[model samples]
Target: ASATERVHLGPTVTNPLTRHPAVAASGIASINRLSGGRAYFGIGSGDSAILNLGLRPAKLADLHEYMQAMRTLLAGESVDYKGRSIHVKWSNNQIPLVMSAEGPRTLAMAGGIADAVIVHSGLTKDVLADTIARIREGERAAGRPEGSAKVWAFAKCNISDNHDDAIDEIKMALAASGHHAFRHTLEGKNVPEELQEAVRVLQGEYVTSQHEQLGETRNKALSDELGLTDFLAERFAVAGTPDECLAKVRDIRDAGVDNLLILAISSQTDDLIRRFGEQVIARI
Candidate 1:
């Protein structure tokens, strides 16, 4: 918390199934207080965290209930659960709740309640537009003001003068898309019909142990076998010169996404961040 004290810091995601709502509230609240209220909490139905434990993601209903209960607890209010009421006396309720969602239903629910929605879909204009539409549906359903929830597009970035190298770098970052959850989101569009079988094979054989680890053996093998490295890189990452990356980000912003969380995809991490921040972010 101290290292990122001046910036907004929080877990990328937490789930209701593994951690109780009251406990989640307490932990996030502690960080908010420790960071002098600079905390932002993100929640989801669970992915690697739960999957590694052989547990399934929580249901939408459970996510909704748990998020509400967490909010109530953070506000220092007592909440009824199981057979008793619980409260966190030290909570300040200052943390902003963000929702990490991919599917339409979850995206809608997020817009209804979350301060922000992090879309894991590719940062294409079409995907951004579709994601925003779903969030608007939720906002309307909850009677919230239009555009109440800010949207963030998640993309891997490896910008450089050597465009080809930049593109190659992102291929390794494709580990994040090894799972069927991400592939299914792109089904019928970004992924072609012929590639569907490859995606299915990954759905069944994906190595959970290598989840999100760049260059993991299984991910590399699948990417090579199905030629998914280039395919996924073209659809999911931002690579090339700084100017090119900036243009892509501008388009995404114009498509209604409020922010971009660039996951640096490079062996030269420090240099990439320095150049990207100075050349791309500054220009934008």
Candidate 2:
């Protein structure tokens, strides 16, 4: 039996430039069926997945169109995608479409259409509130009811008794978060002025090929070299000992984050999950 109730394929790339919307929809639908209707399709406008392929991330317009086509196809309806009418014949699954967004426009668009949103912005109270407000704005603009789009706070987490080691393990993950969160624009992102330049430097230096790789990778080195490890950790991760993680999680919850999507990117991810489940989750 599956340990979790739902399985999500992404925050994977969901742009016309990468794959046909019908193919993406059909793939997720098959997962939904095989998982007994417990699958969610999580999408994003290409990051490492596209960059590694020597392609640019999808423009907002293309992402919007792709999302609409995926929604229609998954709903067992036909959609005109790039002058081609397509539909997923055997898939009529009500798969919840989750979107990962960091920038204001993307977040708003996700709120307007996605069944749920994974906010990859930051974890600070002000940032979270602002992000949610932007999502709500999108919902209103789309004529959707308040709270139509569920919000999930995206965080990098690692739990261990050795606090220092825990932090070290998550540096690469934090670097990935910073690269994603601040890559497009820094405005309205709540990044401190002092660190803005550093963020830019990190963005330019980030190696897409080494993304999320454990052990001493170039991306992980960038976090320290840019003097952004602590800041990135504070803004995007919940690491350290079990108590430390618990406190941070509580703070995030208090900031109105009801749902969390934790990225377990450490080498000891399995152990971290077991520890988190027992020490932090059990307490919460």
Q: Candidate 1, residues 1-284: lDDT per residue as tens digits?
A: 76674778877778777888788888888888778788888888888788899988888888888778777888898988767799897786757888888878888999999889888756777777878898999999999999899998878789889877787656546655546346445442345677767766766766777765655366656666766767666557777898888888788878988888888877788999899899888988
| lDDT value, candidate 2, whole model | 0.85
Off by over 4 Å in 2: 1-16
Each prediction's whole-model lDDT (CA):
0.77, 0.85
**TM-score of each candidate?**
0.90, 0.94
lDDT of 2 by residue, 1-284 (tens): 14566545443435567777888888888877766777787778888878899998888888888888888898899999889999997878778888889999999999899889889999988899999999999999999998989988988999878888888988988999999889878988999999999999988999999989998899989999999999998999888989999998898888777688787877777987888889998998
Span of ten consecutive residues with least summed lDDT in model 1: 180-189
**Which regions of candidate 1 fall more than 4 Å away from where they truly are?**
3-5, 178-180, 183-194
Which residue pairs show backbone clashes in model 2? none
Q: Root-mean-square deviation of each candidate, in angstroms?
A: 2.3, 1.8
How many clashes in candidate 2? Answer: 0
